[model samples]
Target: MPKQLFHHFNKYLELTEEHFQEILPFFEIRILKKKEVLMEAGNMCTHNHFVLEGCLHMFFLNDKGTERTVQFAIENWWITDDLAYLNQTTTDFSIQAVENTRLLTITHDKQGQLLKEFPQLEKYFRTIYQISYGAALVKMRYLFGLTKEEIYFHFTEQFPLFAQRVPQYLIASFLGLTPEYVSEIRAKKRS
Candidate 1:
């Protein structure tokens, strides 16, 4: 684990050096190449990945054979199939490295033990999950209430880095639109 990991933990909870030393062993660092699949659909997602560098996308194939992106995680963000990871069930989606990625991961078992051993970590994770939940709610509201163009512009305005880093096709899928529609929106913006 890196000092930055401790720093990230500290943002949500006050932890001492001893706490860092104790929890460090629970997390393992992994590096992934671009296009690498971290977890495939139907397999148990055993760990929650915290991105240290690069990007990852979580997606699933729809009934119509379209790839629908559910989430994207970049540096300092956590990405996982939360339902699968927490419940220890098979995942309904897949996670892939959108670019060369560096991650720190902790297994569910280790996380449970870590919280038992260090109670403060429970608060830390709760805060993180709460934030994630709140964001999910906002995104859901946007998806239901906004038009395709409004959703596109809202996403671009809120996550400019995502627009810059993720492929347009994936972004379009995430926005519930086609690549050609996204291109048209971009052209209209430039004019």
Candidate 2:
């Protein structure tokens, strides 16, 4: 079991090292190259990935065939097409590596089994879901409440790691701005 995972679980619920060991086998470790596709749109979403390092983006192609990033998961964060993964249905979003990444992946069936075998883990998952949902809500608020430049600045302010680590194009996609606009903003910031 990764000490990082153990520490993450402890953030929500206390689990003995022994007990955590028991649940550890339910997950698989995955290493992805930058731009690797983990899940594609129109495929059944079977796995939920937890980031151990690096980053992942959940995005969809727009009507014009431009990629629109909806969410990103960095180290210690979780990424999945939530509804599709839960319902075992096809996903509208595709998940991809933003950089060379390491992740812990659990299939939907294995997750269910893990929960049944370790019911206390339900609290941990539930807490994660709640936090994810709240973050989504906040993202929506930012989308509506902030200007494009403002949104970019606020997001960079809140997550400087993303600004430094993720490509500016992906950041622009996430903020619903054109890459050129993001370049303009960055140029202005320097000047």
| lDDT per residue (tens digit) for residues 65-155 in model 1 | 8999999999889999998898899999999999999999999999889889998788888888999999999999999999999999999
lDDT of 2 by residue, 1-191 (tens): 36788999999999999998898899999999999999999999999998998899999999999999999999899999999999999999999999999999999999999999999999999999999999999999999999999999999999999999999999999999999999999999999
Please give the clash total of every predicted structure, in order.
0, 0
Provide the TM-score for each candidate, comma-separated.
Answer: 0.97, 0.97
lDDT of 2: 0.94
lDDT of each: 0.92, 0.94
Q: Give candidate 2 misplaced runs (Cα > 4 Å).
A: none
